[model samples]
Each structure stands twice: as structure tokens, then as C-alpha cells.
Target: MNETTLPPDDFHCGYVALIGAPNAGKSTLMNALLGAKISIVTAKPQTTRKRVLGFYTGDTHQIIFIDTPGLIRPKYILQQSMVTAAHSAIAEADAICVLIDGARALERGDLLPVGLLDLLRKAGSPVFAVITKSDLVADKKQLLPMMARLLEFYDFKAVIPISAPEGQGLDGLIDELRAVLPVGPQLYPEDMLSDAPERFFVSEIIREKIFEQYRQEVPYATEVFIAEFREEEKCDHIAAEIIVERESQKRILIGSGGDALKAIGIAARKDIEAFLGRKVFLELHVRVRDGWRDNEAWVRRLGY
Candidate 1:
């Protein structure tokens, strides 16, 4: 057995859950902090389905970030699971980062985070209000009122504004989040990036590409599963299946002359090879699972 080395005395370990509305840049912030792409991202919002852990090890602290699915009003059985997963992290985490769109907060009166504040009222964890995408705005001062509103009704440890894509305010975010953790030994190996298995990531990579390549409800209704992943001497052999709720959706994914499926495979292979640091031979199959998202048994099997 391979023994693991523990960190020296005075090390800190804690879980910080990132919670917010769709498109609030939680995954981007997580990837930026870890300095690696532990969570797959796309232009689409609500792309993350499960709780993805990104571990950051520093000199004195290790922050285990829970990149959760975006909080939304549950409309379907699948969405109910997503919202449940987001709220469940509140109890497990020592701190919470409520990321909000600075511009959206100002224009819409920050209703989403305000509604979610109820979940953290008795959480007993330090919550931080992080305003993302400040680089795109000219008036940074507009964020103050939003911060003020959050502070008025919520118990936030700090209010920080950051732009993950532009590499701004991340140091302060990391430092403050790390400061709240309790002193303990290292929770994981120093070299590990995420707690999820490689198969989970393989599925996520395929799902991310599906989100990018498809439009409208297709991305929302689709799910990807890696049925097989085997590493050979020369390359990794991965077989994945895309499941949709209807047969019509399957046709859209396969496309005319199978061009769309071919494109998805090409794009996913490139990313899988980059992520694994080895060549990957990826094969995809399409299946019609009628009402999978709505059925409790099917949703459970899909890992939602």
C-alpha cells in the first residue's frame, strides 16, 4: 500500500460552497483558484449537474471548493435534484461564496441571491458576497448598493468583487476563504486536483461539448454517460452515450449524414486528450430514454 504524507502542524482544511444563480461564474472562479480545469465550463449556464470538488493546497491552508449546480426553481424532477444538491452543500461547507452578476444585481435588485439568503440564515457558516465580471463594467461603484442590500439582510463575512476571466480579486477571495477554515491536517494529497473520479470527468467533458455544440433545449434535455474508459499503452479508449428524453432530440444530435455526431466526437477527443495528457479514441452513441429526467428511478440512475 502507498502511504500518504500529511501536512505539518497548523495546516487548515475546509469546504467552501459556491452558490448562486445560473451564469454567475462559480465554475470559472473554481478553475481559476485551482490553476487547472477541474470543472468543465461552457458559455451555457446551469451546465454543472453535480457537486464537483476542486482542492487548492497552499502553504498553510487547503480549500476544498464545492462547485455546485446553479440554484433555480425546480420545474422538473431533474431540476429538483439540482436544487437539493446546491442546498445540501450549505451544511457540509465551512463557508459559502454567493457569486452574483454585478450588473444583473444592480438592474434586477439582486432577487436571486436575496431569495437564496434564507437557506444560509441558520447555516452558521461565514458567507461571502462575490461580484463577478467587474472588468466588463465601467461603473464599479454600482456594486456597493448591491453589497449593502445583501449585508442588510444576510450575514456575509465579506463582500468582494472579482473578474475570474481577467484574473482580478482572486487572491483576496482565496485568502479570505482560507482564513475561515479550522486548523487541521491535509484533507487530500497535495498533487490531486479534484475528488471526483476520472470517469466523472470524462462524462463532464462530453457533456460540456454537447452544451457547446447544441443549442436551445437540446443542451438542457441531454445527459452524457461514459459507459467505458480504458487506458492502453498508446491511448485511452472511451465510449460514451448521450441520452435524451425524446427520439426527436436524438436525431438532432446525430444530424444529417451523421455530421453532427462526428463533430462532437472530434471536439470531445481533442479536449479529452488535452485533459488526460494522452491521445484518446472516443466513441459516442445516442439513446432515447423517454422521460428519464422526470422519472425518479431514472434520475437516480443518471446521477442527478
Candidate 2:
């Protein structure tokens, strides 16, 4: 192995799970910390349905951040799997960061779900409370009460306020997390950002566009699968399938004269090319799977 791949003597490396409500900024924080977009982000809730691993390699430590799906009461097989993934990350992580939307907490006066608190209490690893979207809080003084409230519920290793968009309090968050990590060799190469394959991200990119392009149930009902990815001499060839639960949803996706599908394709192709750093020929096909979210077999087949 080369020098970059070899771990330093005092390197600290461990997994830190980021768990929170949907759209609470877990993916945003991970993307900011890694300086790359490994997890997809959208304005809609439950945008992330799987655990995304992002590697933040510093000279002294490599923090493997597990960006998990939002914590929720599952009503279907797919949601159950998503919650399971989040819980599994908590059990396996060296540390856990529970992110709460600062503005939303101020509005609702709730810091966390009772079940989530119970899970953290039982978790063997150290837990930290992170207040995301700090910039959205117009009155900075309100953060004090929110932080105090979180401390009353659990003995968080640290309570930090951060805004991923403005680059606020990120360095301090990193320092605190790094300090808690166990001293060991780097788990991944220094230059590596994530362990997930390229196809996963390519599919995610297409899914993100779907979420952005559609509203309400359409985005939630949709799932993208990359069936073919072949690297060519001058470009790459990719074929993807977009799965929906009903024919009406598929029709909505395709639109009149296939205009909507074409629009989604055009938008997704641009991002795919940018992410892959090569020209791409992306083909998308919509198919109805009939209540796949509630079917355990279909959920597993979709890699949920």
C-alpha cells in the first residue's frame, strides 16, 4: 500500500451515526463535512431512505459519519427497514449525534421523540445533541433555552448549534466528535470519501431529481434502480428503472407525450454527467410495482 493508504500511528477512526427527524439536515451536514455530496437532499420529508456512509479523513483522524434515515413510526415494510437501518447504526457506532432542527424545536417546543430518547439512553456509545439550521433561528438567544432543554433530557457529551449552509460551528462539531473517537488506524484510504459504489450514487442522483421534479406522494412512491452501467471509451452508458406503486403515478411521471419523463431525464443526466465527470447516455423507464413499499419481499428486492 502507498503512504496515503497507510494509517498514521495516532490516527483515530470510528463511525458516528447522525440520526434525526426527516429533513433535519443530516445529509446536509454530512455533505458539508465531506466537501462532497454523497447523500441526496430534498425539501420533502423522508428523502433519505437508507444509511449513507461518508468518510471525513483528517490528518489525525478518519470519522466515518453514518447519515441515517429519519426516525419515524413505520407504517409499512419499507419504512420499517429504514428505521431498522437507523437503529442498527446507533448500536454499531462509536458515537451518535442526534440532530434536532433548532427553528422547528422553537416552534413546537419538542426536542426529540420519546422512543428516540429511550434508544439513546440504552446506547453504549457517547451521545451528542446537535442543533441544525442554526442560521434559520432569527433570535440567537432562543438557542440557549433549546440547548438547556436538551441537556435536561439526556447528558449529551456536547450540545452544539450548527448551520451547514453558512459554515457555522462545523469546525467545533468536528473537533468534539474527533476527540471522542478511539485511537486506531484509518479504516479507509485518506482520499476516499465513501465506500458505496458509483452505481448507488448514480441511482441516488436520479432519485433526487425525481423528488425535486415531483410533489407529494409521487416522490415518496418512486424508487430508482440502475440496471446497467457500462464505462465506454468516450462516455458512460446507464439504464435506470423508476418504480412506482400505481399506474396513475407512472402516468404522472411520464406525463403527456412523455414530456415529464423527458424533463426528469434531462435534469438527471446533467447531474449524472457532473458527478461521473464524463458524458452519459441515461435511459429511464417507469414501471408500476403495486404496493411495493408494504411488501417485505419487494422492499428487500429494492435494497431497502
Identify the leading candidate in terms of TM-score: 2
lDDT of 1 by residue, 1-304 (tens): 0346555566789899999898888899999988999998888888988999999988888899999989888899999998889999987899999888887766766545445867887687899989888887788877777778768877789989999888999999988987888887777888988978888988888899899999998888898888888999998899999999898999999999999999999998898888888999899999999988889998999887
Q: Return the clash pairs for model 1, or none.
A: none
Backbone clash pairs in model 2 (N, Cα, C under 3 Å; residues 3+ apart or in different chains), count? 0
Please give, for residues 85-129, the per-residue lDDT of candidate 2 as tens digits.
999999899999999999999998878965998788778799999
Off-target runs (Cα >4 Å) in candidate 1 are 1-9
Candidate 1 local distance difference test against the native? 0.87
Regions of candidate 2 where Cα sits further than 4 Å from its true position: 1-9
